[model samples]
Target: MGERYLKSVRLLAECLQGFERFVAEPVRRHGLTHPQFDIIATLGNTPGMTYKELGERTLITKGTLTGVIDRLEQKGLVERARNCDDKRSFLVRLTAEGDTLFRNVFPAVVAHGKQLFADYGDGDFEQLDHALRRLRTRLDTPGLVTPGGHVPADEG
Candidate 1:
């Protein structure tokens, strides 16, 4: 069990680090941090989303989201409007400049990232994808003891 844990943890970390290295240059060239790019990418195609939805989609925590959005707002890239249905929350969306940036950067970054995997056959991708989903399911099972040495309150 310990060996399985170490291998899986190291494998996931290595994959993430490789991808970050692959895409980091392009993201920096666009004058954005990795988290900023993540928020922009998540908000790209939609009209808008609430902070909660944005956080979920971007995998960014609330505290980080607010600061990132603040910087983006200062750059005149993104704007937030009062969520009419939920007066306490805001609907965040890209401004015209942001939309332009997204149109350019999204495809550029994706192309660059794809180049790293260009040699992989379709079946290779499929196998990895299947394995990742299986691992995610196992990790999300309730009552499972996590690396923290306590049962997670919920799958989340």
Candidate 2:
């Protein structure tokens, strides 16, 4: 049981790294880092979002999100403005150039992802998706995940 659990954990971690590598290639080719691309992609085609919204949607940590947003701002791809609703937080929106870049890159990256998932058809990933979602839920749920990072026996 221990061996199997260890192997599954390693495989999942490696698969995540591999998937990031696969997606990062085209993003890098477009002269943007993964985080920058992520910011642009999330902020695209919207009026704007607050730092809190962006953090939630991007799943990037506060420290990393701030730096990534700073870099994107420096590149003139994103701009910040005072959030009219809240004085403490700023709203992040793409510039015209950023919108153009997002329009161009979003589809291309998605197409690249589709190519990678070409072998998967309808109904192929439903169970896997459910399993992953379950795992994420377990991880996020306090007291549901054990000290050793395993889900509760009842869940298992």
Best by TM-score: 1
- Model 2: which ten-residue window has the lowest total lDDT? 147-156
What lDDT tens digits, residue by residue, belong to model 2 across residues 1-156?
667678878989898798888888788988898778988988888999998899998888888889999989998999999987779999999999999999989898888887767887767788669878988897777656667777677464
Error of 2 at 50 (Å): 1.0
What TM-score does each of the candidates earn? 0.89, 0.83
Clash number for every model? 0, 0
lDDT of 1 by residue, 1-156 (tens): 667678878989998998998899999998999889988998899998999999998888999889999999999989999988879999999999999999999999999999889889989999999989998898767787878777777446
lDDT scores of the candidates, listed in order: 0.91, 0.86
| Best-fitting candidate, scored by lDDT | 1
